[model samples]
Target: MAQAGGRIRIGISGWTYAPWRGVFYPKGLRRKDELSYAARQVTSIEINGTFYGQQKPQNFAAWGAAVPEDFVFSVKAPRFLTHIRRLREVETPLANFLAGGLLSLGPKLGPILWQLPPSFRFDAEGMARFLDLLPQDTEEAARLARRHDDRLKGRAVLETDACRPLRHAIEIRHESFRDIRFVDMLRARGVALVCADTVSWPRLMDATADFMYCRLHGSEELYASGYNDAALDDWARRCRAWASGREPGDAERVGPRGARVPRDVYVYFDNDLKVRAPADARSLMGRLKLLAADGTPRR
Candidate 1:
């Protein structure tokens, strides 16, 4: 198990879902205030809009302003690089993505998630090159952001508030990623292997980095099922174990566990079809004692 004093972040994949209105957000809550309200309810949120397309600097800045000082936002990398280009020759695309507006989030930015398509199999060389292209810190990210195309003339946020460490997490859907070599590669590169839980995909519970990133799409159903009390309890146990720098005894790992070191854990629920994501996240937070008496996040 991880050592004591590890941080655990619980949140939903996205906060802009229309179904979440009135269900998660209070009735008649202004759409613009939804992010703020949701931030109070959870510790972090995954910015899914960035996955679809590039956003303006102003948008990211506004999002940063909407959350609390300690609130964090994880970004989903653009589909243009993952789905369309399939991580091939994406230097310019990657640069454009960094230059777009992510830096505007500054200290509020958490991990940048790159989710591979279901058809993308594990290619050692290709995967290695892609991982090598990732920036390890905000300073390096700013350097890459400076290479953006003319699309972001005066709008790019190439400068960061501080040269803080940047984290990357990769979510693989193909069964090929189950190989131990992939986990070893992620560990060597300091990139986390996302523990994506879903009925249709392979669920590998390997801890390839100092931090654990999990995306709970659904356990019994792809994106439609809600986590029952038993499921939530199991997740809480696993999360606590991960945070303590130890793998759960029943973890489905690809490699042997190394020396234990405390690790932070980020878990997001993606079972939003029936408005279960937020509620499930909150429930898990409650189980972990992450919520205050007012139902807001404690930290």
Candidate 2:
């Protein structure tokens, strides 16, 4: 709503969780209305379905039409590229993934999250090559999408309604990614190093890009434990600091601070095992005063 320095978007990792039906969504709510309902509750949502497989262009268009104008959806790149191929010789896979209707989200598209597997350690050269393959803007993404093979000939949406800058965030699970050179490379590529909070994986909180992307999986347990009041308060404070282009005093940084420019922040809660993601997101939004009078996030 009224962010002091930069915009802060708090939301859940995904909206189609079965456990959230009666808890978050009304019992009788139609399945098709889930996205609309969730969009009204949070400023953004991380689309987890895309990580599993490629979605149809019509699906993306329908999803875009379901949300509010200010709402944003951060698409998770397919695991076929990140997990299956492990970013090796994936030009065609990457092209197919982008061409498979992501642009249909149009202006509502936010950052593209590429999550590396736990076994994938930091290889500077490999990482650099993969980052170089990523398109920096929608125009470039469209060009790359046009490289898709015959499989996507009839379905690929290569033309962007408005060519805007495309942002990417890398979520690393291996501890090797904590290297200073890794952070430097991401900074040079203008890709955000995701601040992933979890007890099972290495959590890196470096500020590398023009925006901040945070995923809170769990604090005490992975994907199960909800954030207590103290944890939410700390996150709110950090969100404010990042929005103002300043790192937290206790940040687990690797490289020296560079320019201090205000950055938009995107935070998603993934602790959905007990249906806590939505409540935690709402609480964090409340702490940040990002909710409207009706208790939904301000548009």
CA RMSD, predictions in order: 1.6, 0.9
Q: lDDT for model 2, on a 0 to 1 scale?
A: 0.92
- Residue lDDT tens for model 2, 1-299: 74767899998998988888988999999999999999999999999999998899999999999999988999999999999999989999999999998999888999999999999999999989999999999999999999999988798899998989999999999888879999999999899999999997877778899999999999898898999999999999999998888888878887887469888999999999999999999999999999878897777
**Over 4 Å off in model 1, which ranges?**
1-3
Clashing pairs in 2: none
Local distance difference test values of all predictions, in order:
0.90, 0.92
lDDT per residue as tens, model 1, 1-299: 12274789999998888988877788999999999998888899999999999999899989999999999999999999999999999999999999988988888999999999999999999999999999999999999999998988898888988899999999999998889889899989889889888988888888878789999999898888999999999999999998887888878888878448778899999999999999999999999988778877886
Native RMSD of candidate 2 (Å): 0.9
Model 2's number of clashes is: 0
Candidate 2 is scored at a TM of 0.98
What lDDT is obtained when candidate 1 is compared to the true structure?
Answer: 0.90
Top lDDT model: 2
